[model samples]
Target: MQSKIEKHVMLTKKLALSAVIALSLSACGSGGSDDAPSAPRVQNITYEALPAMLTFNEGETVRLSLNTKGEGASGLKFNWTVKYLNQDVTFTGQGSDTISFKAPNVDMHSTMQVSVKLDEANSTKTFGFHDQHLSLSIKDLNPPTTPAHELGEEVSEIDTSVLTTGSTWTETHKQNSRIDQVDSSYNLVDSTLIRSFIVESADQNKQVVGTNYCGFPDLNSMELNASVLSIKCSSGTSSTQYFQKENSFSIVQKCDETIVGVSTFEKKSNEAIASFGSLNMQFKNFADLQTKEVCAVVATSKVTAHSADNQEVAKEEATAIRLVTQQEGNDFELHFAFNEAPNGFFVSLNSFFDENNKATIISGSYPELNASSQSGSLDLDAKNSISNMKGTFNFVLKNDAGLNEAVEGDFELVLE
Candidate 1:
């Protein structure tokens, strides 16, 4: 009986202790402070997110997000806007933690502003003490490229990509009265040059002479492409170029390193520098007078002259003929430019080969010979010194002032 009574008292003590502990736990769970604890609120937000870089291209899609501080993101409202210039742009998502949108087209997008505002679900969406905001700037993938000022027309890929197949680029720069050499600061800088590229192999790309870059530099270090060609220089003064036509394509380069020639030149336009081709044409001269700046070591031709009415004017005699050649893109041309011939005449016979190996003179000049017809057979003999000989030639020629004449001839000539 005494044991049963002791057990009942112990049980009563245990129950009393349990009640006290339960009351303490209840007070802790219910915020039992002198004043009611403040309700949770969104104090701020984290505007940072993954894919760290925010830069994007036109029509690119991207997502931005916001994280709340004083409150859970689910209970918070977000409003996002993109201000482009003076107008607000429409985006895909609002009233959410994240939003996505497409970039505007390149022509339309420049710099843009993106902003977001945060509000509680219980309050109207507007700027408030609890609300926070952030702004971001978006940029374009490609901006306007710097202009290639002195290189003539803007370069195209077809013009530069031709480099990989092995190309020749020549450059000649003249500043102040000097030719083929200059510095960054000068009175005036002019361009005139030529370069020959020989593709020995994939590993042996170099200039034809193996060491110089006429006007266009031999590419080195960087891979060859349409946009950039790097020069190989031991002096560390080399430049990078962008190629685009002619003897050398369009380029931004400085050529003074090493080049040699005076073959075919006009001083301006630099149009006639391609002094290399298969033109062994001998001059049909009317006088033995010393000629002016003709591109020839020596030349003489047996010829006849005529007037517009199909009448022979003079007998064949050695005069002076100047053979000048120029490379126009892919066309090779020979121009017989004469300052003066027998009877105070100014003329030119411009000739090129047709597909059938016939030399045809296409067009001539005003007060100058523009021979537009040809009927001929010509031969070049090395041992005999006969450059263009044993051919019966007929030509119908005209000047810009409409001086038309037809002259046919058989001549013996030597080009040395």
Candidate 2:
């Protein structure tokens, strides 16, 4: 009985193993097929056209054609539309891919947009439709006429003997020249003269002052006996300017064939020197020379002031001075350091002088010394007609603690 039972159990185990092998093969086959077909890919649409930008005149005819590029493109349906000034107009088959039409008349200028769309004949309303566009501008065909003479070629000449050297001339205008002083001596080699002028201009209704110097070159060869005189000037660079004078007054000044300024002047006086003055400087906080006379070099282009005792101050920093003079009443207010004054810790001063050689300091300040409260006064004694000057300055500076510190000194300057 034991052998029979054991044999029956072994047969049952063999049957179970056969069932497991069949189930394994079924799962492998149900997973996937290696040769299964893939989903269809989307089609790409492209085209080529001649004359990408089209321009036509009114009443003219134009022909435009498009050649499509894609798979199964020839089998696709085509729709052509033209839009102009918010209106859309549809065109029918001109053999499917070509358009030939006459441009409409336009009063001034007009633009037309032409487009073509391609799709399957039985396609449903959907996104991703393919289309191409072309822009056409139509206008009246009118060309500009040739000018009589090139601009700047039509200029006249004048006599130069009327302009006298060493004479001062004056003109009154809103933002032009007020006075011009010519040097007494002329540079014979280059036929030029040193000219200085005071100019005032309105910038946003605020007066702006500027001083200009130019080497006025002779243009006598160009001016024969005409009413207009033509003279040239150099800007100390690669620039050369031309000025035309009619009846002893400047009518036009040009550079690079462009007019820059126009003005008229009347002879003011024969006085050579416009105005002259001296400068004095001292520092209370720093130890150097207590006080010193300033040496000045004056020229048409610039005026430079420096300490006569170079050991006291460096040459570069001591020579930072610019002179500007304004004729107000009987006094010439000499503005020193104008826009070139050193900021933060440096002191700048301005003085005024009268015809009698009297001098006074109008303003003085040390920018960084006193941030809150600062007051100063200058006492000036004029030595001679601006050739020499002596002055003393007293300043009281108050810090945040309201503690007042006094700065006092004196100086002398002579023109060289």
For each candidate, what is the lDDT? 0.33, 0.34
Poorly placed runs, candidate 1 (over 4 Å):
1-38, 41-53, 67-71, 120-241, 244-246, 249-416
Over 374-414, each residue of candidate 1 has an lDDT whose tens digit, in order, gives: 33333222332212222233445544666455544432322
- Which number leads on TM-score? 1
Query: What does the lDDT read for residue 286 in candidate 1?
Result: 18
Clash counts for the predictions, in order: 21, 3
Q: Lowest lDDT 10-mer window, candidate 2?
A: 19-28
Off by over 4 Å in 2: 1-46, 49-52, 69-74, 88-95, 119-129, 143-416
User: Per-prediction TM-score, please?
Assistant: 0.27, 0.25
Candidate 1 vs. true structure, TM-score = 0.27
Write down the worst ten-residue block by lDDT for model 1.
Answer: 19-28
